[model samples]
Target chain A: MSTTTTAPVDIFTEKIERGENIEPRDPMPEEYRRHLIRQISQHAHSEVIGMQPEGNWITRAPSLRSKMILLAKIQDEGGHGLYLYSAAETLGISREEMIEQLQTGKARYSSVFNYPALTWADIGAIGWLVDGAAIVNQVMLQRTSYGPYARAMVRICKEESFHQRQGYEIMAKMAAGTPEQHEMAQDALNRWWAPALMMFGPSDKDSLHSKQAFLWKIKRESNDALRQKFIDKTVQQAEVIGLKIPDPDLRFNEETGHYDTGPLNWDEFHRVINGDGPCNRQRVEHHVRVHEEGRWVREAAQKVLSFEF
Target chain B: MTKTDALFHYCLRLGDDAVILGHRLAELCSRGPFLEEDLALTNIALDYTGRAELFFQYAAELEGKGHSADDLVYRRPERRYYNHLLCERPNVDFGHTIVRQFLFSVYDRYLLEELGAAKDTRLAEIAVKALKETRYHLSHAADWMVRLGRGTEESHRRVQQALNDLWTYTGELFEMDDVDLLLLEHGIAADLHTLRALWQAEVKQTLDRAGLQRPADGYMQTGSRKGIHSEHLGHLLAEMQYLVRTYPQAAW
Candidate 1:
């Protein structure tokens, strides 16, 4: 019989109350470790897969200024994935193993990225709401118990703030411009709003990892809580830009003192999460092909590492 | 053309230089000799495109036509473009691409640094912001130059040949015109005279490190800035402007 005696629930609850970090080396519930791995790895995969859409626009960016900003942003996404994978590795997963999971589709990334960036406004939307939602969750993750992830989150949050501002700037210009530009901006927002909301993952009730993940201090807040926060913050930002918040029910509730928003299209969210979104196949197939094509480069890098003295 | 018209053309010229060079590099997307190099080239393309966009946007503002960056990039016909000749040439080979980028980046670094101080506030602002990224890009191209220049006999020979093939186009970069004279009068652009010695020294050091020889200055091509281009630019525009031409305001 394996004699790795488990600690009671109170021990974890006490640690949270005391604001102590739960290091990876510390023995915890099997569920907690698995949940952390799943969440962190999903986050890492999002960062990696996120490169494609932005990269598509790099060649077509209307100006050199937009191109440079996009390039740095995409590179930052790569660097963000590296940090996240390293964070996940602290839990004893190898980098190669994690990458394999992504390559093989055994792991999940944010489904939002599967939506193709059809226009320049799409890029602007991604930077604004997508990144805006991401920053909120990342700010929460900065308080996560894992030391490495929190530190990485700090650096990522700083860079992501710039990304968010740049995206907002693009939309602000469009919103203030010609009627066609305004309509285009509104259409982009309408398409991306729900996806951006879904980036916080499933609702608290639907989230399998929420309760225990919270007790373990791996997740500081519930998905629904983060989503509400994002919606409330985004509405004000939208108003300032002269763009309407697509949801008719989107308003501040004086009674509950939070934003009263309409229910999400959970069916679409679930379908996308389960690999049936518009670009799910496209995104995965592209990734697989690129990974295969990049094998020679990886081999060459390995050879360089082992070059004869 | 009035003085402002000349200034507008000058801005368009710089914008076109970056846009065409960016378009050339964009052809290498996913066609790299290696993945890192692929990513790096795409990244460079992205940077150049971004710089071009800023210039065109500024040009439109200066012209006060309410012309968008897109109107300048997509609506204008070929004869209207005023980019330097060097950037419009084909990406002959890997050696040519790297050498071209290296040569341009060095000049760009000096030009942008000087332009950052131009009396024209918009040009100066754009130059200051662009200088940081160009500095890094120059270092990246220089690093590759040194490596390929010194790596193997074949590599050295290929890069040397690229340098010789490209040398004829370098002269037009410093060739002055009426717009240049007008801009100089306004302290809006640095005289290429101040940049020549520095550009030469930088190129020599890199070439020397790479075991390459400088091409003798026998017959340098000129006049692309005045819209007399080599045969290569036509095909480049055909491909680059395809979407905008066909769709004619398809936002997506």
Candidate 2:
């Protein structure tokens, strides 16, 4: 009933400010929509690219039980990716375009995945540290303003905790086992510690999108705050399992009741984000190769779908 | 062969097939043509891995040698593995994978149905549970068979090529040795010979719908029952057993 078309932006802003859920059909600022699309698609891409490192170990999982667990976990990651892609589709972007963006390096996934899963213990480290960091961020996103994204986060967090537990179990078992296994556990923690910290992304002070995303309720917590929470929870877990935190300067600050750590390697984080990490090229290349190889199959599926209609 | 020995071999064959094929499918995890297909392949992989564990556990118990399922899966040498050669065929492409899966699942579906009613209650129970899963596996692979065969000209060509290449391996699935003859006599195993005709009919029906040609039966591959395999199995086992073999005393 408003005479002016400009009133919808005011209404959308009011709805966001009031912490109302933004349904797919709800009026929203274009910037808010774009931000959600970008954020959600990147999250989805991380879920997918995250599979490669863990998938690397499925064949040599040391035991039948371990192999099955790893395969199921990776399957869940793929399912999460599917759910996230569907949620992003509600924002009006096709999965094809998003994939194109990923392959072309226009979009980014978690830089943590750009590192290789070098050994079997690396799998445990990934599930524990990487997924643990992700849970902290996703738990906050479950309260995000977008209804579909929030719902997807809710389901994903349940499985992520399971993945985290399995990973921690692996770490614990190895940490308590033979000397070689203990070494393997410690080495994995060493390699993964910094990268896992980087998973929360750049500090909020330097993050270009953090301010707008926070104002829109697309992101509820700062990267540094989430990183601190992950560290606080994970340090005790590592201690209980007998694995050392890789940080030399990490200490418990009695004043703040928080574990404070040395400065993160933002240089390496930026390097990985900019496509210079060990597995960045390999990851994207493999994805592109698989996509290209399946072109005929996807076309066949489309053709069959058409025939059915 | 005694009935117990025959049953152990039967379970080993079933377990080996599941684990080997599951390994091939797991290798396709992130390599699927798309995300949905990726998840589908891995889901099937997980199912096969689970089924493999059940079969191996039963086999280990029957062996009564203080062996665990992990020992049967990770400690066995290549020549000792009794999986059908078909299951160990490399996943060369999506067409190859689907064709291989479709071919094997048809035979597996028929085998499990008969095994589900076998006189051996434990094998029957496992088979009944597995039959439910095989039903889905067969349908999924069969659906893709039609899509790929009736899809693009390239897809049709690729899939036909895959079928032609893999046709020789199918004969091994129906081969019966002393183990099968003994188990069949006790009504503890499904008669592979009897299941062959039903498997053929079901496969032919799917192939017809997909417009795929039934490849000519030439020199059908054999020797898996005799512990002989193509070169692929050794490499597959080497990678699969490396971790457990490397640290024999270490607990995972």
TM-scores for all predictions: 0.72, 0.98
Which 10 successive residues of model 2 chain B have the least lDDT summed? B184-193
lDDT of each: 0.79, 0.92
Question: Which residue pairs in candidate 1 collide?
Answer: A63-B49, A63-B50, A63-B53, A64-B49, A64-B50, A64-B51, A64-B53, A65-B50, A65-B51
Docking class of 1: incorrect
| Tens-digit lDDT string for candidate 1 (A85-118) | 8888988888778868877789999999989898
TM-score of 2: 0.98
Instruction: Note the residue pairs that clash in candidate 2.
Output: none
- On DockQ, the leading prediction is 2
